[model samples]
Every structure is written in C-alpha cells, then in structure tokens.
Target: MYYIGIDLGTSAVKLLLVDEEGSITSTVSKSYAVEYPRPGWSQQNPADWWEAVTAGARELMAGVDTAQVRAIGTGGQMHGLVALDAAGEVIRPCILWNDGRTEEEVCFLNETIGRERLSGLAGNIAFAGFTAPKLLWMRKHEPDNFARIAHIMLPKDYLTFRLTGEFATDYSDASGTLLLDVEHRCWSAEMLEICGVSEAQMPRLMDGAEAVGTLSAAAAQELGLPAGTVVAAGAGDNAAAAVGCGAVAAGSCNISLGTSGTIFIPSDGFRVDAHNALHSFDYVEGRYHLMGCILSAASCSGWFVGDVLKAEDFDAEEAASDPAVATVDLPYFLPYLMGERSPHNDTAARGAFVGMRADTSRAQMVRAVREGVAFAIRDCVEVARGEDIRIERSTLCGGGSKSALMRQTLANVLNIELDLPETEQGPGYGAAMLAMVAAGDAPSVEACVGRIVRMRGSVVPDPQAVAAYEERYQIWRQMYPALKPIYRQMAR
Candidate 1:
C-alpha cells in the first residue's frame, strides 16, 4: 500500500509519496502567491491551492505505481477562514492565519466577551488568526457576504471537500478555529452565537484518521488516482508533524520551525494554561496537545541571511560566528520581524536590537540572529514550564534544526537534549502515517510511528553551555517585559 501526504503550507502545497515501509518515495512542491492588499492583511485564493495540489500530486506519482496508492492525507496551515456560498463557491480569498485584520474582533472577544467566558466555552481565547474572530470581521465589514455564507472551513478542510466532496474537518484542525469546545471535541454553541455564525456554516467534525470519503470521480481524474481512493480527515500541520516525530505520548514534544515556530506538547486529556498563553488543541493521536506558536522562526533567519546580509553561504557565516563575541551583550536582538505570538500574542510588537554597540561586529550580529531565535523558542518553553509541562529533552524538526549552531544553542539555552528524527520530512511524513492508519495498514498512530519513525541522533546540552545560556536566557526573559510597554505604545 502507498499513501500520499500533502502539506498545504502558507506559501505552497508540498506533496509527498510514502511506500508501505515508510520511506519517502518522492516529494514535490508548488508555490502560490500570498496577497497583501493592505498592510497587516494577508489573503490567498483557494483555487491556487487546488491547482498546486493537483499538479503537484501528478508530478509526485509520475513514475510510481498508481494502483498501489490507497489513501491521501494532509497537514495544512491552520486557522485561515475559507467561506463558501450556497453553491459551494468561495465567498472570498481566505483570510490567512498570519493576518492581523481581525484585531478589533480579537479585542472584542478577549475584552468585552471576556477571556474567562471565551475560555470556558472554547477551551481557548480569541487570537486574530482564529476563525471565530475572522467571522466577526466578515460580519462587520462584509455583511452582505456573511449573509450568503453556507460553509465556513479552514484551509485544508477546503481541499478535503474538493477531493471527497465532503464538508468535513478533523479535531486537530478545528481546534484552531476558536469555535470548538476543544475539550469535548465539538463545536461550541456559545462561540457560534458570539461570532454571529451558525453550526451549519462549519464543516462536519471528523477525527484526523477518519476516512472523510473516497475521492470523487472529478477529483480522481484531475489527480490521476483511483476514483475511490480513501481520503482521511487530516490534521493541522503542527499536529501532523507531531505524529511524524512520534510525539503522541504524554510529555512528548516536537519543535517545528518553518514559516512559524512552535513547541508542541501532547496530552492524553485536555489541559489549558491558566493564563491562556499556550493554545490547547486536539491532537492527531485521538487526544489533545498544547502548542505555543512564534509567528517568526526560520523566516527570521531567512530574512537576515538571504535578504539583509545577502549571504549565500549560511553555513560559512555560522561557522565564522565566534562564541566568544556571543558573550558580549552588544548584539542582542529580538526575533519579531513580523510581530509575535506564543508567550506574547501582541501582533503590534516590533523587532529591536536592545544592546547594539559601536563595537558590535557583523559576525556577532549574525550570531545574535541565531541566538535570538533560540531565545524566543526558550520563551515558549518557559510558558510550558509554568503549566507544569516539564521538558528535559525534546525531538526537533524544522529548517532551523539543520543549523548546528542553532541546534546546539537550543539544547543548551532550552536546557534539554534535542532528539533528531531520521525521516525528518516533518508534517508531510506524519500525514502519510495518518493515511497508513486510515488505510488500516497500522493499528494506531503510535504503533505506526514506533515501526516507521526512526531516531537518527540526539543533541545533548553541555553543562558549560547550559550555564552560559541560563545567564543569557535570564536576560532574554527580561527583554520582552521591558520592551512590551513600548510595543503597545507604538501600536497606539
């Protein structure tokens, strides 16, 4: 049996083919444009997603035995609001997850509606990216369109619909909507009322491994697959990555640093942080997970190396960065180029270099970018620790994990060992594993991971490095608090 996993990302749809043995046979990607009509607003057409996916799938299976393909799953960008009219036509370009256009709506829910009330109803509070807030923004700004709405879907659920002709979503994806009673694994009536939307507008809730349906004839012909290929209700990208890293067990963790960075911690039962800094969401393991998202992660490094520094030799620059200069406080940086989430949900926060000195060298500044990212990640770990989710070691995957300096810093600054997965395909690999479970090729997600997910090696923290990072981390924690007031003032 063969499974295909699609990672519906912010910039592209990445398709991966995995054989029964769990080896990735082939991988293909197709990019789509993200529109920014207004500052702080982001949108994308659902049609671009469909086209990329179908085209990518054809290429992914170009030389493979199509007859062996049995199931399809996806790890999708979460919390984008995709609306449909009565005839199932897209109402508008989806309001993407990183968009900040719903700030008014978020304030209404977090303040007027009240945080405690929202949390009680949805097991989470409103963030600008959440679906419920997006619904409010639409109702206020696009009332005519809201009245014509027949369906409200997340990004991947939209793809699932096009494939199986089923209006369905999995718990892991639904958890980001702020419309689900996450603890109960169902939509919250209170949330719907507050958002001025209806339950009928939402996709039918399905488990991540539940077979949404066999592919429709129309979809089959377009993608060159069997007419009845099984389509599993897939997970949000982070949860799927968790499944990929074998982080389904309690106390297990997976850190992904792609467009955004997150610390994912799985739990058997639902548990929300008292302050609501951490997001409590359903996991692909048929359980729950708590996640802290940093809006800027690897993108920060990409911007610095590829854009600002114009340096092609990233490895060479990393190698040139001396740890001795890292000891100086002259090159401190905060990784908030595109605003922040996770520990600080402030979208208005701006990036800064607090301790810049005339003596600061270009290499030290480069090292600061790497170290700053690691510090931001540790900020998330600090929030998790507050909630009693202890972390002595964690499995890591992401573009950032490939950097030896960053990984070593993560191990020491976060003060934990970082286990690296052998099949580091991340979310795409996990989505394929979900397909395996849906196809009945595996008993459970955990069982599938144990058999297929291999451990390559682990990065352990040296006592000296840990001690040094502890001092810097103490300083890192203070930077946010000292700068937070300025962040809000600038926003005003």
Candidate 2:
C-alpha cells in the first residue's frame, strides 16, 4: 500500500509518497506566499493552502495507481490561529506562527495574568507566536472577527479538516497553542476563560498517529486518491521531525536547523523546566518532549548570504574562505532577526553584529552567521541541562544540516555527537510514518520509526574546536543580556 505525507510548511506544502516498506517513492512541492501586511506581522490565506495541497497531490500521484494509497497524514507549521465562522468559511487569513504583533497580548498574559498561572494552566508561558496571544490580539483589535470564531484550529489541522471533514488536532500541535493542559493532555478551562474562548471552539484532540477520519468522497475525487483513505491526526512540525529521526524514546534528542531551529528531547514522563525556557509538549509517540525554539536558524545564513551579500552559492562561499582566518578573530552575531524564543522569550530583541572590526571579511561574517546559529542552539542545550536532561548527542536534520561546516560547527559548539539521518525528509517522512501506523501497516509510532529511520553517520566533536567554541560561547552568552536593555529601548 502507499501512503502520503504532507508537510505544510511556512512557505510551501511538501507532499511525499511512500510505499508500505517506508521507502519514499516520489515527492512534490507547492509554494505559497506569506504576507507581511505590517512590520512584524505575518499572515496566509487558508484557501491558498488547500489549493496548493490539491495541486501538489495530483503531481505527486501522477502516473501512479491511486487505488493503492491507503492513508494520509500531515506535519504542519504549528501555533498559527486559523479561525472559522459558523458556515465553516475561514474568518480571516491565519495569523502565522512567526507573527510578532502580539506583544501587548503576550505582556498581558505573562505580566498581568502572571506567568506562574499561565504555566500551571497551559504548561507554557506566553510567547508572541502562540495562538492564545494571537487570539487575545484579535479580540482587542478585531472584535467583529473574534466574535465570529466558531471553530479554531492550527495550520495543519485545517488541511486535515478539508480532507476528512473532521475538526481534529493532534496533541503535539495543540500543545503549542498555550491552551492545552499539557501535563493532563487536555484543554485547560482556565486558559480558555483567560483567552475569552470556549472549549467548543477547540478541535477534537488525538495522538499524532491516531486516525481522525477517512478521506471524504469529495476530497478523494479532488486529489485522485482512493475514497476512505485513513487520515491520521498529524503532529507539529518539530514533533513530526523528531519521529522521523527516531527521537521518540526517552532521553532521545533531535536538533533541526530549518528556517527555525529547535532542540527536542523526548521524555517518558511529563517534565517542565523551572524557568519554562523549554516547551513541554506532548510527543507524537504518546510521550512528552521538551523543545527550545530559536526564531531563525538557517535563515540567518540565508539572510547574510542572499540579502546582505547578494550571493547564492553557500558551499562555494565556504569553500573559498580562508580556513585559517575562519578559525580565529571572528565577530559575534546575535541571531534574533525575528526575535527569540527559548531560554530568553524576549520579542523585543533584535539581531545585531557585535565586536565587528573595519577589516571584517565576508568569510568571517559568514562563519559568524553559522557559528551564531550553533551558539543559539547551545543556549537551548544549556537550558535542558539545567533541567537535568543531559543531551550529549542528538540526531540532526533540516536544510541547514546539509552544510558540512554547520554540522561540524554544531558538533563542536555543543560538544555533542551529531547523527545525520539517511533520509533527511524530516516532517514529511515523519508524517508518512504516522500514516503507516494509522493504516495498520505498523503497530505503533515508535516501532515504525525504529524500523524505518536510519542514521547515515555521526559527527563527533573535535577537541580543539570544542575548546575554542567553549570560550566563544561564554562571551556570546554575555552579549544577549548586555543588549536586553537596548532591545527594550529600541522597541519603545
């Protein structure tokens, strides 16, 4: 049998076809535009997402036997607030996960409502990207639209609803909304009241691998797939990526360097960090995981190379760099281009280049961008360490992981072994694995992951590079705290 995995990303929807054996057969991607109507605000139309997925599915299944397809699952960008009216039409363009227009709402939740109360109810503190803050923003700013919110869902759950005619969400995705009582695995009544939302607005919750419903006849005809194909309750992008890397077992770790970066550590039991630096969310495999997310990762380098330097070839740039100079006299870069999450949940924080000299070379700047991302990831590692979760080694995946320089830098910076997966499809592959379980081709999410996910190789930390990064990271840590006052002033 064949299964389809859809990764509904920030900029595109990637669909992958996998056979019963877990080998990927074909893949297709459909791109959509993200709108920045105002500075620090991001939005996307739900109609565009449905249109892309349908078109991409047709392309993915081209010349293939659609009758052989048994199930479909998705891993999507999480925390975006997609609201629907009574008639099931999208009330407005989704407030995207990276949108930072919720500063007032976040402050209201954290300072006014109190972080301890919010954390006790939702297992997390308010961040600008979370759905609760977005909801509050809408209520205060767009009251008419807020009043029409009959149903609320995340980005991927909207796709699942379109396919199965079911309003359902996986625990992994729901946990990020700052609405779920994550420790209890349910929606918090207190949080619902605080957000001025009712429980009825929420979607039915399920484990990521559990089948929510089958494809509707209309959806099946539209996509050229068999009717009644099971649709699983898919996960948030990070949790899905973790499953793809076989990071479901307790103490297992996975680091992703996509547009955003994360340090994910799966746990057998629920555990919240004292500082609430790491997100405590339900895992796709019916366990729990702590995740620390940085707002930008590979995008930092992308910005430096593409936007700043106007260069397209990253590998060539790295190849041409002076290896001797690359290792010494490097400037520090604070990669808070979209503000920061995890460790420091400061939305006012902005990116900056500190300790730059007049003679700073492009290669040195490039190295700084890469190393800066590594250091930001190390910040999360440090937080997890504070919680006594020792993440000595982790599986790494995503667009940034493709760079050898990044892989080596990350390994040395964190002083941890980095394992590269044979198939770095990340969320797409993980969604496919969830589909396998939903279709009964696999027993459980963990077993399916164990059978399929393979590590290609590991990057062991070099002693010399590790020592050098240790010193640099200490200096890098001080940069953020020193700039906190400036960031607040700049925001005002």
Candidate 3:
C-alpha cells in the first residue's frame, strides 16, 4: 500500500509517495509566489496554494497504482492565518508566518494585554508571526474582512479541509496560533475574546496522528486519488520534521534550516521557562516540546548570494571563503533580514553588518552570512541550556543542511554532534508516517518512527573551532542589544 504526504511550505508545495516500508517512491514540487504589497507584509492567495497542491499531487501519483494509495497526510508551514467567509471562500490573501506587519498588535498583546497573562493562557507570548497577532491586526486595520471571518485555519489545515471536507486542525499546528490553551489542549476562551473572535470561528482540534476524515469525492477526483483514502490531521512543519528525524524521545533535539530555522526539543511533560523565550507547544507525538524559531535562516543565505551578490553558484561562493581569515576578522552579520522571533521577539530588528574593515572581501561577507545564521541558532540552544536541556546531539535536516560548510559550522558553533538522517525529507516524510498510523499500517507514531528513521552519519564538533565560535558568539550577542534602539528608530 502507498501513502501520500504533502508539505505545504512558504514558497512551494511538496508531495511525497511512500510505501508501507517507509521508503519514498516519488516526489513532486510546485512553486508559487509570495506577495508583498508593502514592506514587512507577506501574503499568499489560498487559491494559489490549493492549485499547487492539486497539481503537485497529480504529478506525484503519475504511473503509480491508484488503488494502492491508502492515506493522505500533511505537514505545513504554521501560524499563517487563512480566513474564510460564510460560503467557504477565502476572505483575502493569507497573512503568512514571516510577515512582520503585526508589530503594533504584538506590542499590544505583550505590553497592554500583559505577557504573563498571555503565557498563562496560551503557553506562549505574542510574536509578530503567530496567528493571534495577525487576527488582532486584521480587526484593527481590516475590520470589514474581520467581520466576514466565519472560519479561520492555518495554511495546511485549509488544504486538509479542501481534501476531506472537514474543518479540523491538529494540535501541533494549532499550538502556534496563540489561541490554543496549549497546556490543556483546547482553545483559550480569553484569548478568543481578546482577538474579538468566537470559538465557532476556530476549526475542531485533533491530535496530529488522528484521522480527521476521508478525501471528498471532488478532491479525490482532482488529485487522482481514491475518495475513501484516509486523511490524517497533520502537524506543524517543525513538529512534523522532528518526527521525521526521530526526535520524539525525551530530550532528543532537531535543528531545521529551511526558510526559517528552529531548534526543536521534544519532552514528555509540559513545561514553560520563566521568561517564555521558548515556545511550549504540543508535539506531534501527543506530548510537548520547546522550540525557538529564527525568522530568517537559509533564506538569508539565498538573499545574500542571489540578490546582494547576484550569484547563482552558492556552493562556489561558499567555497571561496578562507577558513583562517574567517575565524579572525570576518564581519558579523545579524541574520535578521525579516526581523526576528524567539528570545528577542523584536519585529523592528533589522539585519546589519558590524566590524567591517575597508579591505573586507565579498568572500568574507558571504562567510559572515553563513556564520550569522549559525550564531542565531546558537542563541536558541543557549536558551534550552538555561532550562537544563543538554543537547549533546541533534538530528539535522533541510536545504541548508546539505551544505558541508553549514553542517560543520553548526556543529562547531553549537558544540554538538549533528546527525544526518538517511531519509531527509523532513516534514513530507513525517507526514507520510502520520498517514501510516492513521491507516493502521503502523502500530503507533513512536513505533513507526523507531522502525523507519535511520541515521546516515554524524558531524562532530572540532574543539578548536568550537572555541573560536564561542569567542565570536560572545561578541555577536552584544550586537543585538546595542542595535535595538536603532531598529526602533528606523521602524518609526
């Protein structure tokens, strides 16, 4: 039998076909544009996402036995707000997760509403990228659209609804919405009231592994799948990626380097830090995890190399930096191109290059871009360490992980062994595994992950490199606080 997994990402939709043995049989991707009508705003048409998923699914299942396909699951970008009208039509472009237009709303939540109360209610504080801030932004600036919101869902849940005719979302995805009472696994009544939304506007919440419904006949026909194929309530990208990397066990960690970066550590109990710097969310495996998200990661590298440098060969550009000079004099890049989340939570934060010399080469700047991202991830690791979460090792996956330089830099900077998974499909693969559980092809999430996920190799930290990075990280850490005032001024 076969299962289909969909990864509804920021820039593209990726579909995977996996057999009962957990091997990927086919993959298809379809790209779409992200609209930016104004600075700090990011949006996408829901119609664009649905069009891409259906097209990608048809291509993925080409020449495969249709009868063998048993289930469908999805792992999607989290926190995006997809508002729907009474007739089930999209009200407007979805406010994407990376959009920084919620600064005012975030400040209102964190300051006016009080972070302590927000954390107590939602198990997290408001950030510009979360779904609650977006809702508040809409109610304040686009009141008409807000009034028409008969239903609200995340990006992947919208796809799931289209597939199964079920308005439901998994806890892993809902946890990022700031509307969920994450500790108790329900929608927070106070939060809903604060956002001027009712519980009726929310989708039904389910565990990530639960079967929401079967595919609708129209959806099955459009995607070339069977009508009765099971559809699992999927997870947020980070949680699903953790499952893909087999990081479901207590204290096991996974670091992702996709469009956004995250350090995900799954735990069996629910716990929140004193400052609420890390997100406390329900994991795909039905427990809890702490995750720190950086708004820019691989995309920073992409922007530097492609847009700033106008270069096509990323490998060649990355390969040009001198290792010796890199450790000593290279400028520190902030890696905050699209503002930031996690410990800082500053939407006004802007990317900058500090300590640059007159003779600084482009190669060194390129190296700084990579090092900057590594340093940003280290910021998260340090927070986890504050809570006594010792991450001696972690599974690594995503587009940036394919770079040998990035892998070694991350290992040394983090001072942790980074494991490479044999099947590095991340969310797409984990989504497939969720489908298996829903179909009874696997006994449980843990059992399926244990049987299928395998490590390909490891990248151990170099002691000397670790020492150098530690010194550099200390200097880099001081830059953010010093620049915070300037960022706010620039925003004004």
Between candidates 1 and 2, name the one with more favorable TM-score: 2
Stretches off by above 4 angstroms in model 3 are 322-325
RMSD of each: 1.3, 1.1, 0.9
Clashes of 1: 0
**What TM-score, over all chains together, does every model reach?**
0.98, 0.98, 0.99
lDDT of 1 by residue, 1-492 (tens): 799998899998899999999989899989999999987889999999999999998999997889899999988999999999999899999999999888888999999999999889888888878888899999999999999999999999999999998999999999999999999999999889888888988899988887889999999999999999998899999999999889999989999888888999998998889889889999865689999998888888788888998999988888887573246464678998777878788888777877877887777887788888888888888888987779888899977888888888788788789999998888888889888898888988989988999899999987887777788777877888899898889877
Error of 3 at 227 (Å): 0.6
Give the CA lDDT, 0 to 100, for residue 31 in model 1. 100
How close to the true structure is residue 375 of candidate 2, measured as C-alpha lDDT? Answer: 93
- How much does candidate 3 score in TM-score? 0.99
From the highest lDDT down, the ranking of the candidates is 3, 2, 1
Tens-place lDDT digits, model 2, residues 1-492: 899999999989999999988889999999999999988889999999999999999999999999999999999998999999989899999999889999999999999999999889988999999999999999999999999999999999999999999999999999999999999999999999999999999999899999999999999998988889999998999999998888889978999999999999999898889989989999865699999999999999889999999998989876555253234357989999988988899888889998899998888788888888999999999998987778889999999999998999899999999999988899999999999999889999888987888889999998887888888889899999999999999999
lDDT of 3 by residue, 146-262 (tens): 999999999999999899988999998999999999999999999999999999999999988889999999999998888999999989999889988899889799999999999
Q: Please list the residue runs of candidate 2 whose C-alpha ends up more than 4 Å from where it truly belongs after superposition.
A: 322-328
Best by lDDT: 3
Residue 332: error of model 3 in Å? Answer: 0.8
Candidate number that wins on TM-score, 1 or 3:
3
